[model samples]
Target chain A: MAERVMAEAVFDDLIHPSTRLSIVALLASADWADFAFVRDRLGLSDSALSKQFATLEDAGYVHIERPVTQHRRRVRVRLTDTGRRAFVGHVAALQEVISTAKLGARSD
Target chain B: MNGQVSESEARLALDAVEARRQQVAAEIDVPGWYWWSVAAGWVVLGALATFAPVWASAVGTVGFGALHAAVAPRVISGRRGSSRLSVRRDLVSRRVPFLVLGFLVAMVALTTAIALVLDADAARHPALLASGIVAALVVTGGPLLMSWVRRRAVRRLSA
Candidate 1:
């Protein structure tokens, strides 16, 4: 059944890590966010955020824009289509796991 | 047993996702500067309507509209915040502009109605009085109204 398949959904390790997951979740909610915004919100250092962004960008889950305006550089990030799909799947998988466990508990 | 443990972890992850989404949603608001500018404009327009000649008042209104049009894209997008984060487009309902516009129209109409009533009562500076009232609303009630509108929009869009 579809339920059985859903219950067996695979967890994406790339997105399962807490910091990455948090970043993806935040990005999933918006079209684009600035680098400083993401860093401040996540309470990550610039280098730490950059590292996470590099990981996601390498996976093609996010797109980063660096533009120079008024001689100042700014970075903006957005979840790519691939990233959004992956995030949706991950959430569904999480929900499935929870639901299946609840069902098992009830039956027992 | 493993399944149960995985399920617990999944539940935690799901909770985190929801929390992060909520945090993003909370951050989706027009900057304070935007609100302050709008409030100032409202007061100025009110003053013009009260004291200016008919042609001058008309010009002022048109000028205000033009200024609003110029500034609207930023304000109505509901993307910018006091912080560096811009809200994601998917989370923002397309109906936000319409809601804001409707609110503005209502405010204008209410202010005009108040001015008319005060003028009929021979109140001094009726336009200024009306503007004062509406300016107060803009300063105090603007955020609350935006919050209510945003909640309603999210609920409706989700449904």
Candidate 2:
């Protein structure tokens, strides 16, 4: 698959919150993650994780799927292309912030 | 968000991101069962060579090879090591399957060498003894190989 080029140094408000940033960072390394896996990994309660997922879903940053299996229903979460781009850009922006501060410190 | 956040906070967030990436990197492994099964199969093949007829031994080796071929493709990528998530291919080395296959081939050579040494010493059941030794290696060395893979993943992520 052809990956879209990430935008440069663009800060994203929707994803900047610590909780959401952690979620996105985890998902960025996976193709799809089980809800329980994300919840347990982040040490968040189901309701709390659901609330965060709902927010990200509304922002079109993530796609949630309920796959029916013989055992039970599973919620699988995937980062959307837009979300990946936003995340990549947000990380770049964070690095830029640090570098600019370093430059200012060097000048001073 | 960037405007209000201080440099130290950005650094911290970046650190957190790296931590999460490392967590995913840790997940890059073959399941524990895969190693056990391979080890068990190796021992079984060794047993067959020791006691079974020539045709039976040949068939057992071929059948074992077939089973391994079927299963290796799915697990060798080190992506689906857990039921929780399928790791992104970019997070794993493309050389994973090659590394695993290379390790197995080396094990085969080791087994042969051990068996030959034992046979020269006029030891009983040389094939069985050799296979048992290598099976132990498979169970132990397999996890070590994956740990090495995980370290490589962490290093690449940090880079």
Candidate 3:
């Protein structure tokens, strides 16, 4: 009836590219990683890792904890149950993209 | 154990501190262009069929039917660029709904098309309607489903 362009907006609910990569890598490989561990693996600065972790934590994809010793405070991070599920989902989405049979891909 | 009661306790202690850093994801919803692309594809096919039904029918196998079905799963989930589904079990578990949705939509679309072809006054035919409806439904409903599931999962994680 109406002549207009239609597009599927698949990027809406996704985590950022860098953040997602870091997240998936972290969630998929180890059950938990410390702030330092993630920072080292992702090659991110302290503030950068902090920013990313904050985002993930807010979205309920990660569980963040801080333990204080005699005086020093350290952070421990783990993939929440939701985070694990999201990681699984994220992997599936990637599979769909890679499914040439499903995508009519020409240049596989 | 020095600064905190124990490693576990310290870990627990840091929970709220790190969690408070979470911010609302700016790109936490599906995109829009993908919807328009599919719609455009269907409209083009409809136009082609109007001009030469036979030619459209032939190409439609690949372009209209196959191409659309091919990408439906990806679009429906609104996750276009994930890179970790190599593990078979992981892939299958998450895509159960997607595969099921694909089959259901195809069956429904085919049934509707067949009905239109058989009906005398179906007006405009069912091919166009079916394609457009499937695309729109998946684009809208798919994300809603994901959003609902994500919230549920988040709640579970919190517990």
Say which candidate scores most in DockQ. Answer: 2
Q: Is the docking of candidate 3 incorrect, acceptable, medium or high quality?
A: incorrect
lDDT of 3 by residue, B43-82 (tens): 5654555456686567865766677678665554433212
Which is the winner by DockQ between candidate 2 and candidate 3? 2
Candidates ranked by TM-score: 2, 1, 3
Q: Per-residue lDDT tens digits of candidate 2, residues B1-159?
A: 368789988999999898888888889999999999999999999999999999999999999999999999999999998988999987889999999999999999999999999999999999999999999999999999999999998888778
Ten contiguous residues with the weakest lDDT in model 2 chain A: A1-10
Ranking by DockQ: 2, 1, 3
Provide the lDDT at A27 for model 3: 46
Query: How high a TM-score does candidate 1 get?
Result: 0.83
Model 3 sits at an interface RMSD, in angstroms, of 19.8
Cα displacement (angstroms), candidate 1, residue A35, comes to 1.6
Q: Is the docking of candidate 1 incorrect, acceptable, medium or high quality?
A: acceptable
Best by lDDT: 2
TM-score of each: 0.83, 0.91, 0.41
Fraction of true contacts kept, per model? 0.70, 0.80, 0.00
